[model samples]
Target: MSKLFTSYDLSGVMLSNRVVMAPMTRTRTPSNTANELTALYYAQRASAGLLITEGLPISEEGRGYLYTPGLYTDEHTHAWKEVTDAVHAKGGKIFAQLWHVGRMSHVSIQPGNQSPVSSGEVPATNTTVYAWTEDGKEGPVLPSVPRALRTDEVQRVTQDFVSSARRAIEAGFDGVELMAANAFVFDQFLSSSLNTRDDQYGGSIANRQRFMLETIDALAEAIGGERVGVRISPFGRLYDLQAFDGEEETWASVASALNERTLAYVHLNYQPTITAAEVPAGFGAAFRKAYRGTLIGAGGFTRELAEAELEKGDLDLFAFGTSYISNPDLVERMKNGWPLAEPDRSTFYGVIGAKGYTDYPVFDAGNESLKTVA
Candidate 1:
């Protein structure tokens, strides 16, 4: 049997296989609440050993898009229970990815049309946010220049992450993953170029890493350390994030810190930006050596590439993004050597109905037409 089909223990949770359904934003929830469609969508892909849901805002201020879900309200928690229940019914395990977009947001999405908050008063360049017009039509809008967060406010934001993690547990998630990558709030603090503050949360790599480490400690305190995972993109320059000196050392220090915590896993996204090149060769091996925990790699990984990494012991699990958008039974398809389906890029996001959501066909040996159980 292929190692991909074998089970692995994540902390105390037993994953059925090594294939992970990487979180991809599909903008199907218009009300920012998981509904029947959301439940069915996740249930369809329950075959994956681990399913990381799309990035969910931790609070109203954290929202950067029009229709993404949240975890702060009772409605949000209850709605997510439906999704978790559906996935659990099919014997699947899942983790909620908590997010805060920080400076990457427009006033249109901010509460009371206020400016977004960030580590400093920097405006993200070469990027646009999903904003809404006066008539409630969604369109791309330039993000506003954000105000620097005060020292006290930074502490509050850390607490917000802790509260959101608690809510995720209440919502029935087996675990929770922090969205510290892709130039979001956490990355803003970690970046020397973006974080120009003179406070303790800024300067030297140790000071710059304070916020993330504190946030991780708080999350581990609220939820068990074994149930917390973090995602990072060390060399990421996405959303106009500028690279500074000591880029490699900064990440190495971050990984060493995580190693001390003994968390469930560290998810590394190799695709820093939509247009960025692949990660430098051997970066994963170096990261694995730094962090002696389960390491999951995400990018445009093929079955062959994933198998190679697992065989070499570099990656304990591999996540699929675009493939999971169309192939609901992605793990089974990869395991059985079935021909995979091409995803419809046009309907990948901002779709209100199920045309491209839960309507994708699973592989059928007897026929070629797409078949959907939902």
Candidate 2:
């Protein structure tokens, strides 16, 4: 039997298979609240062993895009209840990915049109954020320079994460994954190039990691440590975030730190476009050795490659991003060797309706009329 189809235990949750649906941002929540459509979208892909929701802002200040969902309000928690109920009805386990955009945000999305907050006062160049104009049209716009977070305010942000995690539990999520990757708030603190603060939150490797580790501590205290997972992009340079000389040492410290926690998993996101050497050689194995917990790898992974990695024990689970977006029955397709459908890149983001959202056709060799689960 292919290892991908084998059941595995993540923390205490027993998944039916090893295929995880990686989180992808679909900007359908205009009101920053998950609704029936969001529920249907997730329930359609319940076959995945584990399904992670798109990055959800922990607070109004954490919002980076115009239409992403938030978890800081009672209304948001009530709305997400519908989504979690739908996925649970289909026997699926889901996790909420908590996010804080930091300096990657524009004032248009910030509360009261204020400047975005970050570890430092630097601006991310050649990067843009989704913004809505007066005419209600939405598109990418350049982000504004951000003010450095006050040393005392850092703890407040960590409390926001704790509150968000509690809300996620109330909304019926099986777990919560911190968005510490892709040059977001947590990543900003981890990057030596971005975090130039002199306090306990920056400067040395241990100081840079203090915020992340402290956030994890708070999250584990609110929710059990076993129910928390973290995602990190160690070598990512996206959003004008440059690679520094201490990248290896920084990540090693992170891995070693996480090893001490009874966490669920450490998710690694590999950006193929950033460099030809995707994931650098032996990176996965080295991390697995360091963390000693479940490790999930996400990128452009094929079925053959996923199987090989699982067979060799490099990855405990394989996360599919674009493939899951287009094919809701991705696990079945992989099992039956069905041809996969290509996702419509044009409709990948900022779509309002089901045109590019839930309209993807399920595989039908007989070429029958396509139908959505909902």
Candidate 3:
């Protein structure tokens, strides 16, 4: 059985344990840039085996919500450096998540308030991205129909991922993970249901995986493959986009390609962002067969269930989400089986700083100040 505290070697960086803080979206950044409060939040959660920063927009167009921080400009890099330095000072390993929302964004958050990008001209269905208007009310709105990215422009967008990776590296992140999942830009190109374009980037399953494959190569080029990992919600659903059964054959092809490059690890987020129905039967088992490198599984997993799953040899690591939301000392809680504090749903989406973002209590520390959950 794989214990949570035992050290593991991932991408040549020796980790003290296997507990990784999954990439979550938090609006705690200062004025759309990382600041001291954000640094304190993350530095407080530095005990996690590994840390991944919240989803940071690679470009202004990637803003899926209001007040969400980004990694585009020099100021962004400088701001994030404080976070990385703080995390490292606490003896933690951290990775930044590179994000691009594509059609999953509202026009109000974009530069000049223009339409977002998507693989096709159609708009996202059955989904809504939240944003705060001038009056500061959180409202969910449908994204405008995105202009299909031209062949030449596609490289520029991919460059955004590359540039973000470089910025993350420069910001003192030990590594970086590409947000290739969750119906984002990479997700748009990977799903057969979301991408209907007939260009070289679409059509067959191999073609569907092309953009992700190319993005991985581009990111690896920016940062070494050993320091790069990609997150995929292969069976997750949002915006009426879902990949199942043979539709995930692209994952197999892409995983194989990614494995050949010897990237750090591949993260699979297996839960539906909204409904419980997104857990495809036998999906994790199939992914274990396809991926040759380290695999991290994320979803609603309990310690007992995670132990059983790990015993099956399907996942090398388990990413606990909601459980860690208000439990900054999650690893310690796991070690002692402590009861977890409930996360407040009211403040989860685009609120402000230190409310739900940093109010989590660490059990072992005996009511230590509200801390960040990696």
Give the per-residue lDDT of model 2 (tens digit) for 1-374: 78899899999999989999998888888888988889989999998999999999999899989889899999999999999999999999999999999998888878999999999988988888898655667778888899999989999999999999999999999999999988899889988888989999999999999998999999999999889999988787778887776888898899999999988898988646543235577777888889888999887888898998887886798899999888998998899888788889999887877877888877775664455556
Q: TM-score of the candidate numbered 2?
A: 0.96
Residue pairs clashing in model 1 are none
Q: Write the per-residue lDDT of candidate 1 for residues 1-374, one digit (tens) a residue.
A: 88988999999999999999988777778899889999999999999999999999999899988889888899999999999999999999999999999999988889999999998998997888888865777987888899999999999988999998999999999999999988899889888888989999888999999998999999999999899999988788778877776777888899899999969899998654465545667777888898989998987788998888888998898999889988999987888788899988999889898988899989876675557765
Clashes of 2: 0
Q: Pick out the ten consecutive residues of candidate 2 with the lowest summed lDDT.
A: 270-279
Ranking by TM-score: 1, 2, 3
Mind sharing the TM-score for model 3? 0.92
Cα lDDT tens digits, model 3, 131-227, are: 6555766677777778778877787888988998899999999998988887788878877766778988878877777777888898887789999
* CA-lDDT, candidates in order: 0.89, 0.88, 0.79
Model 1 off-target regions past 4 Å? Answer: 134-136, 271-274, 277-281, 367-369
Candidate 2: misplaced stretches above 4 Å? Answer: 133-137, 274-278, 365-370
lDDT of 1: 0.89
* Model 3 lDDT at residue 145: 77
What clash count goes with each model? 0, 0, 0
